[model samples]
Target: MTGKNMKNDIVNKKDLKQLVIRFYGKLREDKILGHFFNHVTPVNWNEHIKMMYGFWENVLFFTGDYSGDPMRKHVAIHKKHPFSLSDFTHWNKLFIETVDEMYKGENAEIIKQRAQSISTIMQIKLFK
Candidate 1:
């Protein structure tokens, strides 16, 4: 890829924040997932986005900016909406697609892998 056309790697919070914002934007429009956030859970976008930035930053960079129980939160959501296997699969697809569209490098790859792992773990715990 040339200089102007090439996408950069995720190197800091700013880049990760962009990824999160864009991913959520896509998620909010998705037919399968949009209802979960728009109606079922009805997230506070401002607060949720901020928390997600911290969450993902900590995940990718070990920044320790986040310190919440994500499992507990997801469990709450599951109680409300009851997640299916397809929900997790679609979430991972959108996440990986968003990451690939915006960035490319080690951190980008790591984030995608981590997302897959998270989805798998969450599914196992939530279903079992």
Candidate 2:
């Protein structure tokens, strides 16, 4: 199962982990979002990775292991600075590329489409 299989219509856990790792790897390298993770007080990268894995697990895999409020968390993060549409666009583009790089499955289209839809919805929710 490729990363595409773990998303959208095809859900799986391993693929979710791949997605999270790849996406965060890109985030760490990306100048736009890399600054946010600069201070990991205790620097427990393992715990941080697990937290992210669990979050994406719940989101992309429907795993019951995660039960936190992402919207609230996003709001908190966004409060530090305004997140513009361009930022979201960059995020979506990176996400799509990561997915494409890791997998090639039928559900890829669904995953990308839903991602765009949700990003737009979140932008609306975030802005107004």
Point to the candidate with the largest TM-score. 1
- For candidate 1, the per-residue lDDT at 18 reads 92
User: RMSD to native for every prediction?
Assistant: 1.1, 4.7
Model 2 residue 55 CA deviation in Å: 2.8
Clashing pairs in 2: none
Query: Residue 69 of candidate 2: its Cα lDDT?
Result: 75
Error of 1 at 94 (Å): 0.4
Assess every candidate by TM-score.
0.95, 0.74
* Candidate 1 runs further than 4 Å off: none
Per-candidate Cα lDDT values, in order, are 0.90, 0.70
Q: Can you write out model 2's per-residue Cα lDDT over 16-109, one digit (the tens) per residue?
A: 6777787887877788766666542222556667787886555554663777776775677678766778888899999889878766566555
Candidate 2, superposed: residue stretches over 4 Å from native: 1-11, 39-45
